[model samples]
Target: MGAPESLSLLNPARHAGGVFVNGEWQRPRGGSRVVTEPATGLELAASAVANAEDMREAIAQAHAAQRAWAATNPRERAAVLLRAAEGLQAHFDELALAIARETGGILAKGQHEVREAIVICQIAAGLPLQAQGQVLPATPGRLSIARRVPHGVIGVISPFNFPLILGIRSVAPALALGNAVVLKPDTRTPVTGGAIMAEIFQRAGLPSGLLQMLPGDAEAGEALVTDSRVPMIAFTGSPAVGRRIGELAGRHLKKVSLELGGANNLVILDDADLDAAASAAAFGAWFHQGQICMASNRVLVHEKIADALKARLVAKAGYLPVGDGASGQVALGPMIDNKQLQRFNALVHETVAQGATLEAGGSHTGLCYQPTVLSGVKPGMRSFDDEPFGPLVNLVTFSTDDEAVALANNSQGGLSAAVISHDVGRALALGERLNAGMVHINDQTVNDECTNPFGGPGLGGNGSAVGGPADIDEYTRWQWLTVKAALPAFPF
Candidate 1:
């Protein structure tokens, strides 16, 4: 017989009890909210809705625990992250199932995100040695050294798109830097996030209050970002909310890192391989139901190949399957909610009315909008200017390399862009001219290594999120130490 009902992964009992704070699982001050699967509309779990008071209490706990955590040696901090990574790997299947059900991500995609989280934790564990400062030598018998230090306590506000990955990406580095953390996950997907992270940290032996999960609405988020006890803020969400958080952090003179939304562009040069370009564009546009911040929103193809490219793109988009997230054969799933589906449909209707042609897929069912492709789109249209954070791609034609580059840089957002061309020199030149923080040559801008500094410019965010040594360096600050060998005379 199949596994017993109690032994099945879908049973809610396998999930964590509720949000965790001060090393304990507890309910919110008031009512609760149910977390549901987007694709099937099934209730996955329920979590307490933390409010302002809960946020304040959690911050106080974090502030109290931060002192001792900061005092702990870097080696010990790294050990905690390492242990967390081990625990995450050990419980990978359970975490993946939770993510799949909660986010409606396809089974394979959900599993991949969980693996990525494990890698992020492992990388974070190395921050103890990686965060070491520089040694400067000025003269003999004199020593000057710069050391990276934690920012006391940090507040992290994560979005729902890649709940676990985004949370770990920011929280891991913060914890590794020895700063206590107060994490406020988006209300919609808090169950998976709370369950996965709390278990890992607990298994890693993290000190009480060093890390806490607070799940609630905008009020809770506001409390965390504005709290005086939290010295730093790391946020991932829309530009509107990011601006508000930045303003608050600015008022308090606190450090802040925000990874906001994007209306990213992908340029297809005349010389690009049609087959490869078509494939990459399809993957970049529809991956994760186009919920990714780096998803290619606009495709600027050279006029010479625009028609051919459009045909191929339409064919590819038409074939994407939409079904329950648990199905192995499912490639694309539903949007997070009905509101997003309506917004996407309205954008398509508006774009078509403005003269853009619907090249493929525009059907909808509940929360799922079919993978859509539109052509003859221009800057004046909403699809060209706004971020269609659903599975939609707008195709626009350009005449020359310069025009392609110009069109790609026209948007106020500059998170990421890709240039697909076989010519090395041309691709490099275009890469230099694009206004995005990241420009990929002959490749899609979807994959990012944790070591790379990842963030965007213009409307994207103020600082980088992941990439290079400099990327991870944003997680810390610096302090200088000086010593005098001889006593100096004091004068009043």
Candidate 2:
């Protein structure tokens, strides 16, 4: 693929990677990280690798903004979000291209993420209209009601994959409900994770200091989570890091929302349509090069249909081309960086060494590992027991329906599961038994929409209000209010 004909350099200031605090770009005090394009390993830009001192300054600014923004009219706040969506759409090209370059996603995938973000903004704009609390029956001459209130500043730590979508998914709702935010985009994809929003909202009339974009590494993340002024935190990343954040949250007793890792499973029964099952596997296992946390990590097929399903999946996967996402026609893109590329390769080698047959693509060049499929894999191997965030899928054979459900629930991180069968009732029934937050009947595991209950159970997520419109309350607190027509008789 050639450089996108429509793509051009972003504003020099944005590419320079200044942190946005108090509504303006903050130059690096000294240290910085050179962000390189993952697919090609070419220098894209230098982003500030902010330290604790820088983070403290950003947090202080966010607290001040939260207080001021809380006083603004909710209706006005909603209007700003709508306009921000407009801003995102208007600048779609630059934002999409940057996502492809930094994150190693194909152009189509980048465009898809941007679309989800636009809808998130549009939907979140209506959140203010729901702020009216329900009145409750009270003692005579008194009224009682519960009202949602913002929790000052929210510390948002986002990941590299789907940077824009995940970043805005948490950001839009927080802002809509009057909370200030200090966002720490992944060091791997600072521009899409931080700068894009900074630019979009700067033009969309959001007050200065309300949204701070800090492009930094784990050190900065530590600073954000420990900062008492922020009061609350939302994080989407690996479970190991999530646990560390959890420890800090407990230490401070701050509110936290965690969307963590998954070792998702896809199950196919003997009565299932092999064609549909194969197609679902290809889409769910290889999309984004299998970087999604909810990716189809393993396929469990009933022994009666395992061979046929394997053949169909290999054929379907062969038809899908692989290359740089900037080529505009790519499906599977490169791993985010060489480290991820190496980790992906290591998992594949380990799986085969554990007696699993290398049944499909396994060769690689640079960061582009082909979509892979393995058969006869079982428990104990990292490929079988752990989540590998790359385009690799392992096959396992199951006997009874009970066995299938048991295999699907084998992982500690059960985020999503899919059951495919001809009998809808059987599929639905199996779906109910799977240990996942989301189960897809007659489909695959990788699907997600803007308006669903998106988090999983166990270490998969903390379930602090995300996924649906009901999540508007995740970034908010509740307060009870009461009034009396006249002073009620005081009871001492």
Candidate 3:
């Protein structure tokens, strides 16, 4: 049996309901939005929605708190992050269940996200210790040095897909660099993702007002972004919105980081192992219903093995279980909402009309779209350039390696690409020609590590890196200093 659709049907108080401001929960000034269980259309909770006033208060609180937070010892701040990781592990089951309910995520996926979230916390904890600086080599009777410092208040706007992981990754890194965060999580799953982080940080003994979680729709995000108090923004969503943010933040000469979705692709060379390639495709194309920004929009296969790869993918997609996430028995779960499901179906229909043949599931029963595979996909098709961001994936064949690389690079840069080949030399050489911020060899496109420099070129948003020890550079500002004991002759 699956879990009930509504938290009201269970222990209502357990839902971490309300907006988090100044290290505390507050009633929304603009009312609340119903958070529905996508798998069943059941009301999970009424997440508090923030209005302009609420957003202002949160930003003000964050700005005020940032000073104290920056003044605190970096090592002590790191200690808090490490403790928060342990606390997250202790509440792992509860967090996983909340993630499944909030996002309609399959149990295994919810568990996987929680595990990734914890790892992000752990990595963030160690980052503060690795902050680096350099001393200048050329100077007489003087000292010259450069060091990184916090960017003060930062506004983090995260999307619904993998909310817990995405939300925390942004928040943890900013905090590690001694900055305060005013986070606006996707309204759909705020409590499970945003509010939960506030809870853990509070329990971890983080200072009050250091981090605020505001749960609301796009209006709230806009208010947070356009505000002058927030000098920086870290956004993860579509390129359209990222452009708007870039324009606004640029107007103010403010710093911003974006991780927008892209039309990603992968290539399968003829010599690759059939079963291994097939498994990689299934995982990359269908995990979390293919909502990842790095999910494959199209796959280029060597013509020699195209037929075999297509058959394997069809068998895998056709055999995969699909149902409500709470059942813990299905491999695939529901789309976030009906609109995405509609788009998924429309894209498939249009692609088929454009001459691609459907080899597996393409329709839907409510929000649960059957994993779909389409062959003979061409560049001009709606499905070719459009990133459906669902379980639907396309297969296109290439006769030569140059053609495959061309197809992969054909997109207007945003995400990543993968090259699967038995020849390491060939794979590495081909990877060099791909246009992306990240590339994988003999691997899938849908991949991330907590300590990697993740983000891409094109419309994927630039000017920041949100992962690894390198994150200190993005979340903080750098200053060069020079000191002289006495006046020296001017060379100017």
Candidate 4:
């Protein structure tokens, strides 16, 4: 079985069954919450819940630590991040299991998430050494310089889907850039998203109060956004929640990076390899149960090849396995919970009733939704308009390249899009026309690399990106300084 046989991987001593703040575990005044494994409906662990007071303490600790952390040698900060990457690698199995057990992602997906988290940490380790400023042109006997400095306390809010990756993508970079961080992971996957990061960083020699893990509810999140101590907020979740955070943060005059979800797309041109495109469609639409923000929301295909692609996708969906992730015997696991399951069912059923054809896979058993395939999905349909955060392969036909681009751009989201065609130049041309943050040619929509700036426009994100050089801009403030031999005398 791919499932972890026991909870042996979790060390109670390390996590302390409490929220991590000031580099130590403290029982949250909000009491404890029993985390349940989404795939099995089994008790995973009892995690501490941070209240408004706890959030205040976490932010205070972050503020206190940031001064010291920002003053440390860049090399020292780099060392901590590098060691944290090593720590993540060392505890890969434990983290992977926690991800699978808590989030309903299969073991393989958990492993992939851990690997991505490690890579991001390694990338961030080098950020401390990157160029932090520039020397500007100066008049004779004067020097002008521009420098980047850390935002004192950064509040990071991460989601349950791909928790480790999302959490660390912001946390590692913020800390590496000499900022202390207060991270609030989604309450559903606290261990993998919050406490586990604390454990790894603490072992990696991160200074006390530098990283605070406060896994709590919406109240805590609201408090973090509104708190003056948190000068910046990096959030990853749905567009609705992102908008609220943005509104709240804006009121506080805080800088915010909103990495929100989207109704992403996978476009298949008539000239594409049908087999490859079909496979990509299936993978993009169903991977991680389609909970990914970049998961293909709509498959826009040339009407000429739409029938063939739909047939292939329908056949693939019929046999794609669905069961408990802990068993490790399935291709797709259960939805995060019954609410998500019901939402998926309602969306699919409503779309089908609205003249869309449910060609394959519309049934469910408990929380395990079948890999669903729908055709004849038009722009106004619920399946086309709504973000399909489930295994629903929606096929929308377009007659021409212009029509495809028009159809793809007819959404509020602009996160990720994929264009598949044998002609590289043609695919690139079409991709350029798509109003998406990231476009893939001859590939699927879901892609991430630490070296690449990742974010999209419109409802998906706020046009600000993260990763690579983007982190330098995202986590720091630029200051311009000029100096002369003495203070220049003004006319008196």
Q: How does each model score on TM-score?
A: 0.94, 0.95, 0.94, 0.97
| Deviation of model 2 at 305, angstroms | 1.3
Which candidate has the highest lDDT of all? 4
C-alpha lDDT (0 to 100) for residue 235 of candidate 1: 88
- Candidate 4, residue 111: the lDDT equals 90
Instruction: Quote the lDDT for 16 in model 2.
Output: 68
The pairs that clash in candidate 4 are none
Candidate 3 residues lying further than 4 Å off, grouped into runs, are 1-17, 485-492
Residue lDDT tens for model 3, 63-160: 98899888888799999999888777777777787788778779877888778888988888887787457888756788998878788999998888
lDDT of each: 0.81, 0.84, 0.84, 0.88
Q: Quick one: how many clashes does candidate 3 have?
A: 0
The regions of model 1 sitting more than 4 angstroms off are: 1-17, 137-143
lDDT of 1 by residue, 1-492 (tens): 122434332334533335678998777784577777788887767866889998999999999999888889878988898888877666667667668778878877778877888788888877777637778775565578888878888888888889888888888888887888898887788766655676678778899998889877888888988888888898888888999999998998888888886668888899989999998998888887888888988988999998889889888877878877767677887888777778888998899999999988877877777889999999889989888888887899999888887788788866888989989889889888888878888888676777778888877788566534653466678889766676567996
Candidate 4 residues lying further than 4 Å off, grouped into runs, are: 1-9, 13-17
lDDT of 4: 0.88
Q: Residue 341 of model 1: what lDDT?
A: 79
**Which TM-score value belongs to model 3?**
0.94
lDDT of 2 by residue, 135-242 (tens): 888887788998788989999999999899889999998998889999998888888888888878878899999999887888889999999898899999998899
